[model samples]
Target: MSLSYVGTQLTIYVGSAILIAGVLGNGINIFIFSSVRTYRNTPSTFYFLVGSIHNLLYLAINLTFRIVSVGSGFDLTRTSLAWCRARSFFLSTISVISFTCSCLATIDQFLATSQSAHLRRYSKIELAYRIVLVTMVVWYLQGIPWILYQNISPISTTCVRTNAIYAIYVSVYLLLVLCVIPVVVMIGFGFLTYRNIRLTIALAELRADRQLAKMTLIQVVLVIISIIPYGINNAYGLITTGMTKDANRILIESFISTIVSLITYLYYMGSFYMFLISSSRFRHAYHTLCDNTTSNSSSLLCLVDDDYFCLCDINQIAQCFLYDKTLDQCKHCLAQGQCIKGDTDTPSDYVCRCPRCHFGSICQHNTKLFSFTMESLLSPDLLSSSFIKKSVSLSMYIIVPALLLIFGTISNIFSFVTFRRPKTRLNGAGHYFFTSTIFSQLSLFCLLSKIIHIIINLRGLFVQPMVNTILCKILSFLLSSSTRICYWLIVFVNIERLYVTIYPTKRWLKEPKTAKKIIIFVIMLTYGVHIHELIQYTIVPDPKYTVHGKWCVTQFSHSLQIYNQINTMIHYLSPCLVNLICTITLLIRPARIRANLDKKKSR
Candidate 1:
């Protein structure tokens, strides 16, 4: 048999073993961490619980996919676009979540063992849940682009990226997310944790503290070791693509690829073993759990030694198991000013469960130094009353727009009259200013119409008047075209000023005719670009709102999102960039001119 065939067979056998062992191990880890009260309450264990779940999923999905594809020669992921996208999305998202949870556990351990009380208090179960929730949301959103751009190849019957650029982007993104960022965070925090342990050896000697630090260090080291080879392989593949076509080089790359694949799987498998070997507490918990199962006991009692498990009477066991044993004494609650004694039936339940911000088993933390409710400051009903609502509406939609319309119309008219005087009419600069005032007046008219529409809608007086197809199209087209023209006319005026400032001897650029031609071109260009508004926008019936009423709506294609992005870049961002450049040049020109004159005088 060929060496490649032998290697493939060996991988199949070894991979199957690893898959079974990893699934069993992670399943046990989850059961023990969740069942034991000691492990369940601690913050780092929450991260470990979540990480174990993610690792189990990663191993099962990834290993099973590989096994099936290799053994039966059937690749389900290559069957359709949905499968391809789903396969990539799940694989990437789950792997990243697993790594994130591991990193969080390390950080939590460091904080929990810190000498600073503020940092130590941050190690709460609620905070761990919040962090995990945010991580899942962020990673899931990050996978959306992958789903949008992945496709199935018809020739090779495999899933691949749709664009070469996107392929390169995914490679770089994975390199950073999977390797670079994680390595840096783990190494930096790992070093700090080690130093803290060394300096505070007496504090670190506690069993719980030592266990947390040891487990976290082992996890960090395992993560760093497992990911390095995969990262290197990714970098090599990205660098070597299309570079050479030698058969020997191809074989070498394939060998490295297989080794990296195995190494990646090793990461998923090694966590359970790491926990088992690094912590005696975890081992003892596992053994007790196994012993209980073998003895066929259905009791809730998790019998660790007398010190670990909170042993109490049968009735007290339920309360102690549910909450901390410290609550039974009620000293912490009595110290706070909120204790309530219980009746004869359950006299031990003297701790009052205050429904406010206080910590500890008996609510002794007293987070509220100055007790006050949010409603006392600002009531929701008061804010939502008719007077406040109308005041805001009148100021925004009525008063502001009305004042702007009045001032803008009067100013534009005065400017027109001033520019038409004999002394200004023949000036090239006056022509540009004159054209700009005209477009600005038109733009103001469009704005006034829109504000009136908003006011009418707010009053609920016009249900379907503007919903007519022709009216909708005409209003949209007029508003967009006028606004664009107004902005571009300002740009033209700036350019004219810049030209005059730079080359005072250029007579053609100083002509009024040139200004007029540029104004005509600006108007035409703005109209042509926004002509789509006339066709794309129309009236659609709104059955949910009113039976006979319609709404003005614009129908969009899949490419509309891309078009919107390009439109924003060109119309909004391009003008700002150009205006900034021109302003800077204008500011610097005087200084440069003065410097040149000074040099000439000295010569």
Candidate 2:
């Protein structure tokens, strides 16, 4: 047989096995995470639960479609534009939502282990729900663009991007959003969370936190590994598109693409196994679920409250021996190996007891077989020192922000007052500085509100209404707009200074009226550019603290990439480039002047 045929056959068999195993595992994960009270209540578990559900859907839809298409040359998605769009939309939505939940889970852990009590308190079950809801809405909307862009070819039964540019844009976007951003955030937050857990004071909480962190970290590492090949393939395609194609290049690209597809399948299949291997709690829950299914317990109550007799008590020797002597009572006991003839107090009465690690009257429940000990892994002094370090970290959280807020507020106020004076305002460059100081003051005010919020949250007295939508939107706008305006204002001031240095004869450039006009233009231009923020940013309710009120956040996903690119250009890159050019020009002008003077002297 040809190598291609062999490889194809292997892929079909392996993919089928993965589909079955992943569906079964993820289905069980969903059941346990959703049903178990202890797991259900946890914020990280909520994220994991949502992720598992999406993963199962992804595996069912994507894997089954791939397997069928490969084996029988059947492609449902290629039958119509609507089907293609729907398939593309759902594929992107599920993948993004799954990864987003994982990212949120990582962030939730970081917040839960934060040195700040206020931040830690934010890690609640209700918050997880809100985040998941927001994520779903955002990703579903994000998939709309894909639906619009994807089409089925009329000549060939295939789905493809509408054009090469769109394809390139998507490849780069996916690389950043799916791979780069998630990997960076997970690793960065994972490091911080690990450090925080190491310094946790309570032994029980420490162990639990450590296990969860380790589980999340391992899953994140695996996800990064699986996606790296896909990212490289996307990047390679983006760079090599429209280039001269050769057979060797085509062969190499084909190999990479195949490998990428296989690894991506593994990504969808591996999460359940990762949890099983890395998490003892997950294993215990799985075992408990299995035991419950096999046991004759009609209700979970019978498993916990074993004292009460239920309909499932048919195997109970004591009940059988107590009520009826006509039946061979010891015969039932002998079958269980828990009792023999004359072993009990009497023939009619019997003693029934389960072996170790078994519970319930009939020994139907199986408890966890292994106990984990961390004392051997962690030193006693380290545990004691963690308590002291935590107290110090908490104090720093309060003190550092407070000092910065107080000093920054005072400095900005003084700068604003000094620059607003008529003597300073008349100077062209001073006007720009004055406007910049005003923005600086506004920015400081926003910072002050944040610090105050933190303090109030620390005291457990903060109300949610204080962070309502209007406040959140206004604060976000002010922070972003003010920061951008400050950057541009500084750039304008530097350019104005360079203008006067290079062209002293241009008197109009030094006029306060000219400076005033430029300032007005800068304000209008920045406000126009950032107007979308006013619409996109709004107050979202904290699911856990609805009574207290909501916090501000941006909604929608379609325009965010474009919006961010514009902001980066206007706020950061453009200003830096302008300032650099002006500085170089100004420096070179003085050198040119001295060089001309030397030439004149020699003449």
Candidate 3:
């Protein structure tokens, strides 16, 4: 594979891993810090809590966008000016806030561990909270200039600093403020923390109290190790910006930078693991929490989110055993959302907290209202890819769609042949019917493609990014456009039939040439109406997969969703109304004609 392709795949696989690990680690840290009474009382753990919160924010907002943009080539910042400004603003603000918290935590660890009573007094939870608030406000204020000055440049078409001076200021800010200053603070405090540990441990009275302190010291070491390389990478980039480099050298530098960028994410994803690794008490506490033992700690109420709180028995993290019984049970939410970690109070110890538009007890229901994908309908019942493929019974999704394709292929071919005859080309309906059959057949194949797509991803098979993107966009467009156009074509047919009935005496030869042009017009109009299906759909990584794979997903903005609803009403509902009116008119018009003929005969 080419370097670009290799780089893209690396981002997809590696970036996905980082996103998952980072979110889980940071979230677990928050849960542990907030739940444990001993932890909640400490100023250093308070800063760690704040840092973890920002780490979650940073990973959710920035790393997600990076994977989507670089791995899948759907960069939202390029298209939306609002996203361009907001993304950089949050990214910078959160990075700084998290780093600041890290620095504060390191300093607090030193203060809390020291023998001096006055220094220990400085490590109050209240003071830590105030410091975090002030740091957030300061960093957020610093980031306002980014929102105002960030723009999608005409040349690069990437988010750029429109002001040269501010761009330089940002680079300097990243280098000195986030990188150099935090590293210095962490290293300095870390040294003092070690010295305090030696002095305090000699007294032999403060061992339990020093467990968190030791965890913080190790965290400080991680902070320095992760931050120093990032700082060096930035310094190198800045130093070499004006220098002309050959293609090979530039490519090598780009690869190195990518690796360094991944390393920088380690600080955010590493804290929980760092604690587990360094401190035996912390590890024991984690184990105790997982085992749900009430021996050491009482059941404490923990805030799960703003809306809900859970009583923690202190054992499993949120939804640890989403696979309580088997691998299938583990992926019971179909791997779409978090499981609320639970105890034996209920039938299951985990409740699925689904992503947006998904629901049901185990998150089995997807609110893809009016979506026609067969795979969606069968998602709740889907088994492991291996089990489904190896079992004798075909899935409902496969069986029903498979049968429909078989009959659909046969029927459309027969219709196409019937419409092909010169005698059938008497009016517009014949032409419309002919084209409808073509899209009908196309739609069936698209259905077949969808089934294959689901199965391939079900088995966790990787497709190249560019090819996958194209398939995702094209398959969705064809299926949606064909569905819409088929409905409208039926409406058009009824309208044509009504026209012929009303003015049958005015005999003008309806040539196929005119019919052909009209068909082209209708086709163009149909595609134009549903064009957003192509623009809005994209391939995103599927966490359900054991190996690297993607799911073809569509997301519409609020305005677009509104437009789509209106659009669906127009394409889907309008045809039914038009056809209903046409059918009624054709029936009534013939009876009225018969009545007039009877009156003439009596005369």
TM-scores of all models? 0.47, 0.48, 0.48
Candidate 2 residue lDDT tens string, 1-603: 644555467566777667766775687678778877878877888898999999999987787677656654446677667878888889988988888888888888888666565786687889888888988998898888888789988877689898777777678778888777877888888888887877865422222355666778877887788887778777778788789999866766675576578787776778767876677553221212322443655333222111222222323211111223323235322113243244355653454354433332222223321111111111122223477864565565457756776887788788888987889877688899888877877776775554444334333454555455455566656766787899988988887888787678886877999988999999998888777777766433322222443333344352453344435434665576567646756665676577679989999
Please give, for residues 445-555, the per-residue lDDT of candidate 1 as tens digits. 766665455334334456555464565677667776776676776776676777777788786766888878877887888788767667776544323223343334454
Q: For each candidate, how many residue pairs have backbone atoms clashing (under 3 Å)?
A: 0, 3, 6
> lDDT of model 2 at residue 453?
43
Q: Which RMSD values do the candidates have, in order? A: 23.6, 24.7, 21.0
Q: List the residue pairs that clash in candidate 2.
A: 464-548, 464-549, 469-539
Candidate 3 matches the true fold with a TM-score of 0.48
Local distance difference test values of all predictions, in order: 0.66, 0.65, 0.71
- Candidate 1, overall lDDT? 0.66
For model 3, residues 1-603, the per-residue Cα lDDT tens digits are: 666667777776687677766776787689778987867867778888988999999988887778756733557798689999999999989998888888898888787677665786687888887888888889899899989999998998898999989989988998999899988888898898888878754322232246777787788788777888889989998898789999988888888777778888888888877876676443212222333445546555232332222334444332211123332233445325665555545534566777655544544334543433444554445444567554533465677778999999999989999999877867767888998999998898898787677667556575577787787788878987887788877777786777677777653424566667767877899899789989977665544333454556656664565466546646765676467656756776676677679989999
Taking all chains together, the TM-score of candidate 2 against the true structure is 0.48
- lDDT score, candidate 2: 0.65
